[model samples]
Target chain A: MYKKPSSRRIKKFYAPLNLIPILDSVFILIFYLLMSAQFVKIFEIGSDLPIMADSPPSNMKDALNLTVDVDQDEIRIFTTVNETLYKTIPLNSDGTFDLTTLTGILATLKGRYPKENAIVIRPSSLIKYDDLVKILDSVREKGSGKSSIDLFAQIIFGNLGG
Target chain B: MGLRFRGRRQKKQEFYLELNSLMDVLFILLVFLIKNYSANNLNIPENIVLPHSVASKQINQAIVIQLTSEKKLYLNDILVADLEKDKELADGNIITALYDKMVDAKQNIKYKAKTLGDIHGTDEIVNLLMDKNLPYKYIRKIMFTSQTAGFKEFKFIVEGKE
Candidate 1:
């Protein structure tokens, strides 16, 4: 006679995982990150000292050589190649530099001379650094986001009185 | 009746707070924070209000030169000189104290590069953090000094205008 196979049931136990300690550690980590986080974004604008070359590069012989002279009352945009004065934008009636006009003029120049990438910035001794940076922002590019275009990206710090 | 009441009380179910979802949310938060964490060690001084710019170039590790609104100069967070006194000490357009400091910094960088077996010296870049209200004369002097000390690339640290 064949014996019938005995059926047995295995009991499985489930244990709760301890999470209080993990929660404490996570809270500590979050607090530390929040304390050390940089809330404000910091960035850089690069400028180079004019190269001490005897002659201009062959490709740049007829370049625009754009130069911007910033003063307390007015900003003069001119070309160093032929000393051609492009435009002079004066401060607004509210005592602020007219960046919109500057940007418009820069965009026009960029359209006419698309290959010219260098811009010489000569800020007067009286011009504040803040104002100079505003001028730089206006000169660096036009528009924003996807439609933005670089006006003059190669920045050179012109001489004190040049 | 008292034994029957005691048996009923003993049969009451135990309650537990579920935490798996909270743990999952915390893990996601940790990953997000870790992904966005930046290792830049540049510590902006409280007295120096950086100029705002639209330039998007991220700042890199380099020798830092800071000019506070009070005309104080700092090299890598160490108070090195007072600009007011240094102006009188400047030789022509170069600030003597800053020039000497930059020379020392360059030498230190070169020495470190040599120890690391780099034939060319480290990048000749300097990060300039100047107070927004500072006059360009001071900045000119600093740039001239740094140039004379063999630093060719200048990065002006600015607050990002988003």
Candidate 2:
């Protein structure tokens, strides 16, 4: 029982895990995701149908019902309150809308009536959707980042006669 | 000479790739891609160029209506009416064909909500994907048709840009 222990060492057998299949699957998944990825970001601008009545409701009478009339050559800013004309900004010499002037006017109006949120946009048949969106962008906000001021957030699409 | 030959054989056998680092990098990439993946299923057509805007409101689930620059009207990617040919079919401002399609779509959504236990209910919302170059008259017609079809809320889908 006390004899010397054998000097022969015991060997450990370890089987390596094959990772080829996992790598193949991972590569396929990455390729599929890359193909289906949405590169362009899509967003939305909300609007409401034009009210049938010529004037806003009694409750909204005090609020500034701002209306923007976008034509081919000029953008007319007005309010339903007493049918007042605020400003008329003509297109630039390069045939682009003067959005900076429109934003300044909207900021002034927003400062005057902070509670009023509704605004009606009436784009003429000649104005393109791109131009209308640019006008909308300018009317929705004034500055950028933390200093940005929200203008008319409630947008209503109105017809020419409405 | 025998020891030198054995050492050369061992060196040849040890020429294997170290893939642990590669696996770690791939796993990180996979996690990143999965996290940033968007589930938005809106398939904007190639011909319809959405207008760019600073509006950051994310798009919600709603019935989609597309208007191409060619004046083709599509409800959920199904061509319902051609503004060029169906000019007479427009009753005042509403496109009759589009209105019918929208009513059908609304009914289908309601039925799905009832059967599938969806809680959103009939919100009467419609998302409009329009070409940037399209005139406002076409948009007016679409909006009138949608309103007549009982869609109260409208959202314009546009490409997001700084």
**Highest lDDT: which candidate?**
1
- Each prediction's whole-model lDDT (CA): 0.85, 0.83
Q: Scored by Cα lDDT, where does model 2 land? A: 0.83
Chain B TM-score per candidate, please: 0.82, 0.83
Error in Å for residue A119 of model 2: 0.7
Q: What lDDT tens digits, residue by residue, belong to model 2 across residues A96-133?
A: 99999999998998898888888888888878899888
**After superposition, candidate 1 runs with Cα above 4 Å error:** A1-11, A17-28, A59-61, A160-162, B1-17, B117-121
After TM-score superposition, the amount by which residue A8's alpha carbon in candidate 2 deviates from its true location, in angstroms, is 12
Instruction: Tell me the tens digit of each residue's lDDT in model 2 across B1-162.
Output: 887689756664434566778888888988877876767788899889999998888888889999887778888899887787776854367778888888999988988898887765354999999999988888887888888888988899999885
lDDT of 1 at A111: 96
- Classified by CAPRI criteria, candidate 2 counts as medium
TM-score of 2: 0.84
